[model samples]
Each structure stands twice: as C-alpha cells, then as structure tokens.
Target chain A: MVTISCRDLDVDLGGRRVLSAIDLDFAAGALVGVIGPNGAGKSTLARAMLNLVPTAGGSVAIDGAELVGLAPSHVARRVAYLPQGQEIHWPLSVERLVGLGRLPHLAPFSRIGPVDQAAIESAMAQTGTLPLRERIATELSGGERARVMLARALATEAPALIVDEPLASLDPGHQIEVMALLAARARAGGLVLVILHDLAAAARYCDRLVLLHHGRVVGDGAAGDVLSDAALDAVYGISAWRGEAEGAPLFVPLRRRD
Target chain B: MSLLLPLLLMFALLSGLLSIAVGPAHIGLPAMVAAIEGKGDPIVRAILLDLRLPRAILGLVVGAMLGAGGAALQGYLRNPLAEPAILGISSTAALGAVIAIYFKLADTYSWLVPLFAVIGAVLALIPLLALSARGESALTLILAGVALSTLAGAGISLALNLAPNPFAAMEITSWLLGSLEDRSFKDVLIAAPCVAIGLALLLGQGRALDALSLGEDGARSLGTDLRRTRLQMLAGIAIGVGGAVAVSGAIGFVGLIVPHLVRPLTDRSPSAVLLPSAVAGALLLTTADIAVRLVPTAMPLKLGVLTALVGVPFFVRHLLRERRLW
Candidate 1:
C-alpha cells in the first residue's frame, strides 16, 4: 500500500515558523482526519506534503519516493487535491469543470476521448452532480460548488485524495453526505485525508485522527484512542464531552464558564 | 466539433481572397482566382500575392499569437483580466517603438523598431513577473501591471512630445493609435516566425495551463512545477506578444476576447482553449482587416480602432457581469 510519510518537517511562511518538526504518516485505504485549532499549521502540513511550500528541514516521501524527486505530472496522476480557496474564472459547466481532472492523464495537444468522458461522467455521478452537469459551476450554491470540486478530485481517480476543509460552508445534511462519500472512498481502498475544524464530524466520520496543537502532532491513532476529553481540553483549552449517538462517536464542546 | 478546424481554415482562405478582391483596385473573384493560379496579369498577381496577401497573413499571424499569448497568461496567472495590453508588454513595446521612431532609428534600420520592441517587452516582463510571483495575490499582479502600463504610456508620450521633427511626432501619434497601414511583405516576413514559435510554445504548455486553473496550490499538488510553468509562459508571451505588438502596434482585445468566445467549444477546459483561441483570433483579425479595406475612406482606417470599438463593449459587459457575481 502507498503511504505519505513526513519526518521532522518544519515549515516557514512569511518569515514565521508555522510548523516545527512535524512528523506523521498517512496510509492507504484510510479515512484520516486532521483536526487542529486556528493557526495550528494543519494547512501548512497539507501544503508541505503537496510540495506547494518548501520545508525548512527534513523531507516528505510518498510511496517510498521523495516528493522533491518526483515530476509534477507523475505526482498529479497518483494524488488528487482539493484546495481550500476555491475560485473559478468562468461559468464553466459542471461536466466541463470535472473533465479538467483528466488533464494530467492527457497529452498537451490531445482531446478528451471515450475513457476521459467515462471518467468525467463517473465523477459527476459519484458526487450526485450528474443532474447538474449542464449547470455552471460558478452559479451553483456553496455546497454544490464543494461537490463539484470534490468531483474534480474524484475525476483524477487518484489512489490518494487530500481535501482541506471540504465541509466548511456546507449545510449539515450536505456535510454528512460528503463525509459519508469520503468514508466510502476510503473503504474502497483509496486514501482520503481531510482537514477539519468540526470535532464532532471528525469523531463521527474518520477512522483515524491526527491532531495538531501549535504545529506539533499532539495525538495520532484510532479516533477512540486519540480524541479523549483531556486531549481536547489540552489542545483547545476548553472542556468537551465525548459519547455515542446513533452508534457513532459524538463530541460536544461545553460553553465557557467564564 | 471535429469539423471546426477545417471550417475555420476554409473561412480564413475565403476571407483572405475576399480581402485581395475588395480593395480600391476592385480585383474581382475571377481575377483573384487567376492570380492564385498564376495566370492573371502580372500587376494584378503582384498586388494580390505581394501586397495584400502578406498584410492579410500578417494580421492572421499576429492576431493568433496575441490571442494564444493572452490565453496562456490568463491561465497561468489564473486571472481573467490578464492580457498583453493590461499586463504592460504591449505598452512597453510601444514605448520602444516610439523611441525607435523618434531617434530616426527606423529610417536608418527598419528592423530596429521590432527588435527593440521585443527586447522592451521582455524587459518589462522580467520585473513585473518577479514582483507578482513573489508572494503576491492575483489582484496585486494586475495592479502592478496597470502601474507599469501607465509608466510606459507616459514614456511614449514624453518621447513623442520631445521629437525633433513634426513628421516624427505625427508618425508617433499615428503609431500609438495603432495601425497596419502601408505594411509590406517584408514586415510580414519579419513577424511570422516569432509569432509562430510563440504560439507553438503556448500550445505546448496547454496541459500545464489547465493545471494552473485549479489555483496555485491545487496545481502544485497535481504535480505542476509552478516556477517552470511561469518561466515558459513568460518566454512565450515575450516572443508572441512582443512580435505582434512590434508589427501591429498594440492591437487590443484579441487575447482577452478570443478565449471567452472559444471556451464553450472546448467545453471550458483551459487545455482545450488554446487552439480554438488561435483560430478564432485569426478569423477576427482577418475580418477586421477586411473591414478596414472595405470602409469607404480617403485614408485607410486603423485596425486597432475597430478592435477597440468592438472590444470595449464586451469588456464593459464582462465587468458588469463580474460585479453581479462577486
């Protein structure tokens, strides 16, 4: 199985040490959730893995290959990404936007063939966006746009998918639906790594949890083992209750007493 | 859809022939056909082959290059408003051309203008791109481009105002307004190769441009080398836009408008937008050239005026629409 491993990674952004000696491993066929407070360097970790930002020290390796040594097209074909800041230039149709996922696989002068079309259609269908294929992505609602972006990542059909705050701005129903989709993707033997701020959703959906506090990995293990009350209180400086709701783990953040 | 290329090719040929036939000399279709087959009168053949054909071909090449260059820039920068005109290349080239003209450099060496224009365009890109690429937002890049363009414009105006001869000032003014007037086959020969190579470079990077559209972070994660992509794009813009602006004198909007027009044909994929934009640009400039020749005027109409007249409305509509959305 393929795995993304980072060893003693440090990241500096705008002259600030956003992350310090970050060490972690993300394995295949796992729904790995990264939970952290604001400014905790979760996004920085994701960027470092993608090689979008340079590491001040140490290195990241994917499937035994150093990230720095791999070509972009090679990495692109194996790893699909969904960025947090989504901005589409034109009112491209849903099908058209999703079809872009095949870009890495196609030659520069080539057109989309039957295989590409099939992939596009499958991605749209997987995200339940087939009915909206003709609609413009820019005109879609926030949740719909998020789904469209997810479909773009799915269209890559990569073994590994990384999404940053995919549930942000999504409604509760759509959030659950998207989380279920991620879980299913992981179950089907694809790696799915997501950055999330919602502790309850992270507790309920992800099989494994990686928590960051001030750029260091505070906890890493199965969700049940890593997401204890003490850990939450220490990381967030707040009290929280953990329990079960409808056969799934549920987390409730207590209101501040002060 | 597959038929688009052949269809556009056919139109390009037809429009080209129509351009030769409709000028003041009024060479009919039969005469034009004979000229093509090399059976017409020598003068008629010379006019068609030597005079009109090169001008038409030059327009086509320059337009296609600019269009392709603009598409590449917008895709690479991930900004819709990015184009040669707005990004300072054209204006810098214009300033270079003005310098060439005012110093009587064009009189001594006709090729000096295009060469300096090219160098000036590349020079402008070096600083502008460096400033923008170093942790600047897309908006900041556009703003920087505007500032540079204004500086170039002011420089051109200063050069014109300080010219020693009245003829030089008039030439500079007319050139600044932009034209393809009195252009000969030699001008066409000079620009064709640069434009062709630039277009090839841009088209070669189509897949890279697609990756860029997904945003810098997304593109990076997808294995796109951002620095290399930026370098390729800058080189292509310098060659294509520099050559076009050197020859055509800052024709606007072909780059900005062509992609929006052909996007649907390629299903809005940036990778797909390159060639269709090239063809669309060729058609547009050829048609505009034909219009200038057809308009009944004692003096020839400037091609830039027509493009701006058409482009301004579209730009306004786009801005209004963008406002509504944002």
Candidate 2:
C-alpha cells in the first residue's frame, strides 16, 4: 500500500502563486478526482507531486519518504505521471512509445528484454490497445491516442498513478473505458488520482472529489459530501445539481435564476 | 542484407590499401605494404610511410568524426537536417584555421590552427544555442543554425578576399572547399585526439539523446537535467568538428549523409544511430578519397567536392520525398 501526503505545498510560477499552501492525502485503493475551473492549479498540483515543477514551500512525501530525496527514476517507479498535453514531434509506433515507459526500470546501456516485453504486453492488454500496438500513435484517433498514452503509463506498473485531464479528448465510450480502468486499478489496491474538468463524470466515477479554487483546495471529501450547492457556487460561481443514478453520484450544473 | 557494416569495412580497407599503392607512381600493393611494414626498397618505403599512409588515415578519421558529429547534432537538436556545415560549426572552424594560416600564426606555432578552430567552433555554437532556447522550440533552433551558417559563410568569404598573396588565397580557398590532399603525419597527429574525445562524448550520451527527443521539457519531467545535456552536446560538437575541419578543411555532407545512411541500419533509434554513423562515415570517405585518386584525372579532386557531388543527389531525393527523415 502507498500513501501520498502533501503538506502546505506552495508553487510559484511567472511571479504568481499557482498552488497555495495545500494539504491532502491520497491513500492506496482510492480514486481521488481533482475538479476545478480553468487555471485553478489542477495540473500544477499533479506536476508538483511528480516533482516536475520546483516546489516553493512545504513538502511532499510518498509512503513516508520525502519526494525531494528520491531520484527521478525511483520516483517514476513508485509514481507514474501522465501530463495533460503530451506530444511527440516525431512519428513513433504505439508499441515503441509505450515501451519508453520502461526506461526508468532498465539499466543504462541495456536493451529492452523479455521482462520489459511482458510488461508492455500486459499494459496493452489492460488498456485494450493490443491491436493498435503496431500502428503509429500520431495517426490514431483522439480517443485511441488517449488509451495508448494511458497504456504507456500503466506499463510502468507504478502504485500511484496521477493523470492530468485524461478525459479531455476522449469520447463518451472511451471515457467510461478509461474511468473504469482507473476504478479497476483502484479496486486492485492502487492509488488513482485524476484532474478532471467534467464535474458530472467526476461525481459519477470518483470515490472522493477535491475541489480547488484560485490555487487553494476549497473542499475535500466523499463526492456527495463535497459537491454542495454553496461550495460549487463559491468555487465556480455556478450552482450544480447533485443527485444519483443507478447507484452512481451525478451532478448537473443549473443556470442562474431568471 | 543488413551487412552494410562488413561491406563498408571491406571497402575502407581496400581503399586505404589502393590509396597507398596506386599514387602518381606505380607502386604495387605488395611493394606499398612492404614499405609500410618497413622492409621495402628505400624509395617506395619513403613514399608510402612518409606520405600516403598518413593521408589515408587522416581521411578515415575526419570521415568518422563528421559522421559521428552529424549524428550527435541531429540527435541533440532532434532535427534530421542538422549537420556540421548546416550548423555553421565547420565554417566557423574553417575560418579559424584560415586566420591562423593566413596570419602565419600556424607557421610560428603549429598548434594555433586547431586551437583557434576549436575556439571558433565553440564561439559559433553559443549564438545558435542561445537563439534556439529563447522560444524553446526546435524550429527556432534550426532557424538559428541557418542564420549562423550565413554569417559564418560571409566571414569565410571576406577572409579569402583579404588574403595577403596568391598562395595564401589558393590555400584558403582549398581549405574552404575542404580536402585531404597534402596532409602530413603532423596534421593527423593533431586531429586524432580531439576527434576521439568527441566521438566518445557523443557515444556516451546515446541514451540521453533518446530521452531528449521527447523535448527538453518532457525529458526534464522524466528527470533529465537539460543544462547538463546541452553542455555535453556542445563539448562533443566542438571537439568532433573542430578536429575534423582542422585536418580536412571543412568537409561537408558526410555529417548530413552518414546519419541518414545508418539510421535504417539502427532501426531508427537515435541511440543506435551514433556508432553506426561513425563507421559508415569512415567507409564513405575512404572510398571517396580512393575514387578521387583512381579516376584518372590530372588533379585529385578535393574530398569535400567528392562528398558534395555524391550527397547532392541523395539530398534532393530526400527533399522531394518531404519526409525530413534525413
């Protein structure tokens, strides 16, 4: 089991505070969704957890080990990160792209061996991208590309998975597939944290929701407990209906009263 | 057959042997080999050992350096079009050599030529690197490289025009054209160490180059330190091209062509491209140098001219395809 704890974490970007003093804990076997409006530091928080961005103040620890003390490859082994706007300038096959995830695990100067191949195959199978492995990743449709990228992350076999806006380009069917994959991973005792713009999707699939506004966490708890009308209005300046369908939490944004 | 490596090696050996033997005089292979082994007639021994052997070896080294240098540049910039010439490193080094030669600085102190050339190559790299980093895009880096090439070309042309005498002017022009002609053991001795150091640096950074292809920000997010990689690339380029241009007078196209030729052999991975490019480069230049000697012409053509002559067609073909894989 893994636990990620961020204590009073602050990040400064372009002379502006992008993430204020924030504290949160993500335990293994939980799906935590970060929901916020644009520029609410969702991506920043994910990046900070990966140590992609420099931390301005406070600390982050993964399973009681300080994130700062870990090397990148070591961090990569424990915590896999999928950035929102990943792009490859060159055309590479999906398999090759996914195989890159095994980099942190392999020894320097070592070629990809049978163990890596097995992991890649398992990852492709898990994400249902096995048939598309030979195709060029850039040539795939948007939803297919998203799955391939997730497969790449899964190839790492990391305990803690952090995804930034993973649902952005996914279609409805693929969206559920991805969310189901994350939920499956969480049920299998992995920590799944995702930043999502779709409140309804977040409410439906996520076990807990963390709301952010202006670089600070506004609310954190079970989805139903946190997605209150007042909190939604204060954070997003809009009221959202909270309900349930088929035993899944559901949210619907309401227009201001005429 | 994917046996290009063995084929290239065979051709390089054949060229090296043929070059030492079939000079202006008809010294046969047996005689040349005997001479090089220090057991032939005095005249043949002098000709082979004192002259032809160094020239052939220098060609081999310069070619290897250019090939390896080109591969590294392409890998670092993630631009297939990047070459020693395209990036202006060769021109800058050529200019440094010319200045040293024309001012009689090399005559006074033999080490000055390569020293100045290396410095000039490093100097040229600074602006290119700086310009590329401003916008943090690979396209901007290529543009900056082109701009440096233009400026460095103008500097070389102006230097040639301002030469003190006809002999200096001729030497300068020939150096600009780039050749392995009349190079002695001394020149070979001066170039070998630098080229070796450069190749070592490039080959060592092979995996790092693979990481870099994902872009600097991506690599950093994956835990690579960008500043360190950039410095290592700079040091590699300076040593490789600096040594090559010092000996061969700015041979072009080898750096550009060798990578493309070897990329397929290495399954298109940037890390796999490094050493294979070096080997392919050595073979190509050695064959071209031999071709120059064997073509039955009054004057042996410059090695640079031979490479450009061969490279232009392939370059055009790549351009027509519009793949930018080269």
Candidate 3:
C-alpha cells in the first residue's frame, strides 16, 4: 500500500502565497475528490504534492519517502499525473501518445520492449481506447481524447494517480464515465485523487471529499461531513441540494448565496 | 518507419556516390574505386581524393546537420516552420564567415572562419533564446529571428561594400550563395568535428522530444527536463550550423523541407522522424550539388538558390495551412 502525506505544505506562485500551511494525508485504495470553486487552490495542492510547483514550507512524502528533491521521473514512476486540459501539441497516433507514458520507466536510449508494450496495451484496454489506437489523438473527439489522455496516464501503471479538472467540457455521459473510471481505479486498490467540479458526481462516487477555498483546505471527510450547508455557503457562497437518486446520495449546488 | 529508414539510407548513399562520380569530369565508379584502393592514375587519384571525395563527404555531413538541426528545432519548439535559416542561425553563421573573409582572418589560422562562424551562430541564438525564455509565442520568436537575419544581411552588405576589390566582392557574393565547389579535405576536417558534436547532441534528444509531443506540462509530468532539453538543443544548432555555414556558406531549406517530406512515413512522431529527415536531407543535398555540376549555365547555380527554389513552395504551402498558428 502507498500513502501520500502533506505536512503544513505551502506553495508560492509568482510572488503570492497560493497555498499556505496545508496538511493532508492520502491512503491507498480510496477515491478522494478535491472540490472547490475556481481559484480555490485545488490544482495548487495537487501540484505541490507532485513537487510540480515551488513549495515554500513543510514537506510532502510518499510512503515516508520525502518527495522534495526527488527527480521528476522518480515522482512520475510512483505517481501518474494528468494535468488539466486536453492540450496535445503533436498529431501523434493514440498508441504512440499512450506509449509516451512508459518514458520514465524506460532507459533513455532503450526502445519500448515487450514489458512496456504490455503496459501500453493494458492501459488502452483499461480506458477502452484499444480500438482508437491507430487514430490520431489530436483528431479524436473530446470524450475520446479525454479517455485517451487518461489511458496515457494509466499506461504509466502508477499506483497513485492524480488528475486535474478532467470533467470540464466533457459531455454528461462522458463525465459520468470518467468519474466511474476513477472510482474503479480506487476500487482496484490504488490511490485515485481527482480535482473535479461536479459535486453530485463526487458525492455519488467518491469515498471522501476535500474542500478548498482561497488557498486553504476548509473541510476534509466523507461527502456528508464536508459538503455541509455551512461549509458550502462559506467556501463557494452557494447552497447544495442534498438528496438521493438511484439509491445514491446526490449533492447539487442549489443557488448562489450573497 | 523501419522500411522507410533503409530506403532513405540507400538514397543518401547513392547520392553520395553520385556526388563523387558525377562531378564536372565524370570519374566512373571503377576509376573512383580504383583511386580509393590506391591503384588509379595519379591525376585521377588527385581529382578523386583532393577534390570530389571531400566535396561529396562534406555534402553528406553538412546536409545531415541541416536536416537533423531542423528536426530537432521543430520538435522542441513544436512548430513545423522552424529551421536554422528561418530562425536566423544560418545567417549569423554566414555573417561570421563573411567577417572572416572580409578581414582576411583566415590567412593565418585558416580555421578562424569556421570558429568565428560557430561563435556567430551562438551569438544569434542568445537573443532568440532570451525571447523564448520570456514565454513568448512562437510567432514572436520567429519574428525575432527574422530581425536577426535582416541585421546579419546588413552586416554582410557592409562587408561587401567595403570590399578591397571587385574580385573579393565577387568571392563574398558567391560564397553567400553557398556551394561545395573547390572545398578540400581540410574543410571537411574542420567542419566534421563540430557537426558531429552537434548531431550527437540533437540525436540524443529522441526520447525527450517524444515526451514533448504532449506539450510542456505533459512532458514535465513524464519526467522530461524541458529547460535542459532546450539549452542542449540550442547549443547543438549553434555548433552544428556554425560548422556547416563555415564550410558550405549557409545552404538553406534542406533542414525545413526534409522533415516535411519524411514525417508522413514515421507516424509523424517528432523524434521518430529525426533520423529519416537527416538521411533524406543528405540525399536531397547531395543530389542538388550534383545537379549544380551537371546543369549547364553561365555560372553554376548556387546550392542555396536551388534549395530555396525547391523549399519556398513547401514553406508557402505550410504557411497557408498553419496560418492560424500566427
């Protein structure tokens, strides 16, 4: 089992303190959703965990191994990160695009051998991107591209996965599928942390939710505990419609609170 | 990609041989081989060894440098339009050579021309790199390159205007047009080392370039060092193109067009196309040099002229398609 712990972690972007003295712990085999309104430092916390952003204070450790000063490849090997947006620069085939995830594992001059090949195939299968392997990723539809990108991250076969804002701009069906995939990954004994906006989806699928507001974690616990009306009003200035559908609890933002 | 690589190699080898065998006086294959095995007539050996052989080898090496340099730049900047010439590197290197020629600096050290050219290429790269470091658009970086090219052009013109005599001015003009004509083994030795260093640096970036296809953030997350990659790539361009310009006088377009020609066969993966593009560049340049020798004209058509003649149409088509990038 793997664990990521952040102790009083602080992050600085430009000259501003974007993340301040944040403490959190993530254990394996759980689906944790990080939810916040825009500019609430949800992304910053994720970045700080991976050491992608500059950390000004405190420490991050993966299974008690200090994450700071770790090489990016080393970090990538232990944790797969799928950054926000569907921005692909080249018109590479989906197979090659996904194969790129094996980069941190392979020697610099070495070709992708049978082991890497199996991983590539497995990731594609997991994401249902096997049939789209030959298609150019840039030309793929939004849902398909999202899946392919997730496949690229999965190809790393990392035990810990962090994806940022994955549901944005995807259709509702695709959004549901994406969330289900994250939950399934967690169920299969992996740590899956996702930054998402859909509170209902998070409530339905996520085992836990961490709420952020203005560079600080306001609440962390089960959806019922963290998505309380008072927390919602203070953090997002909105009220959530807490109810149930298909025997699953749903939390929908009802209205903006002044 | 596997099938395409050998095919490109075959074409490059054939063109290299053609470059050696099909010069102004056709030294047939048998004669060329005999001369190499130390059995041909002495004059034939001199023509083959002292002249055509070096020229042919230089063509292959310089052409490969241009091609590889283009591929590396295109891959890093993620733009099909990037090449040493368009990025102002070639022009700055040419300015270095012109300065060496104008000041008669080569009369003593003889290697000073190429060394200065390498320096010039590096000098031009500094500003371009600085602009890119500020997170400017590719268009802005390219425009900065254009400005550098214009400045180098003005510098070359100053050298031309202050030429000691008409003969010296004519030599500068011909050299600026670029050719492998009359270049000896010494030229090859001087250029090959620098080119070799540069090519090694560029070709080494294969994995990093592949990772970079996912954009800067994506590549970084995949363990690619974007900063180190950019610096190494820029250094490779400067040193490689510097050596090439010192010898061949800034041959253009081979770097730009060869990648376009070869990309389709490599699944368009930027890294996968690097080697094929280099080989294809060697083939195209060697053939073009041979054509200049065979094509009847009052004066031999400049290799740069031929390359631009061929390369401009491709550039125009690419611009039209990628105009949205600007």
For residues A1-258, write the lDDT of model 1, one tens digit per residue.
668999999999888888888888888888999998999999888888888888899899989799989888888888888889676765677887888888788875688899999999988888889999888788898889999999998998989998999998889988999999999999989889999999889999999999998888999988888877678768887777778989998888885434
Whole-model lDDT, candidate 1?
0.81
Candidate 2 global TM-score:
0.89
Q: CA shift at A61, candidate 1, in angstroms?
A: 0.9
Give the CA lDDT, 0 to 100, for residue B306 in model 1: 83
Residue B254, model 1: Cα distance from true site in angstroms: 2.9
Evaluate every candidate with DockQ and list the scores: 0.58, 0.36, 0.55
Residue lDDT tens for model 2, B72-153: 8888788777886766677788778878877879778877877778777878878877775544455676677678778877
Q: How close to the true structure is residue A251 of candidate 3, measured as C-alpha lDDT?
A: 79
> What tens-digit string does per-residue lDDT give for candidate 1 at B1-326?
57776787787677766666667687888888898998979999988888887787887888788778777777776767677676787888888888888888989888888778877887887777777777535566677778889999899879977988888899887887667766777778668877877887788887767766677777776666777776676677777788888888878887888776666565566766778778778888888888887788787788888888988898688667655433
Relative to the unseen true structure, what is the C-alpha lDDT of residue A242 in candidate 2, on a scale of 0 to 100?
Answer: 70
lDDT of each: 0.81, 0.80, 0.86
Residue pairs with clashing backbones, model 1: A72-B223
Error of 2 at B83 (Å): 2.2
Which ranges in model 2 have alpha carbons more than 4 Å from their true place?
A237-241, A253-258, B1-15, B18-22, B85-88, B109-111, B122-158, B165-167, B295-300, B319-326
Rank order (by lDDT, best first): 3, 1, 2
As for DockQ, the candidate ahead, 1 or 3, is 1
Give the winner by lDDT.
3
Q: Residues A1-258, candidate 3: write the lDDT tens digits.
A: 889999998888888988887899999899999999899899889888887776899999988889876788888898998988867877788999999999999987898999999999999987889999998888888889989999999999889999998887788887888888899999999999999888888899999999988899899999999999889888888987888889878877889986
Question: Each candidate's interface RMSD, rounded to one decimal?
Answer: 2.2, 2.8, 2.6
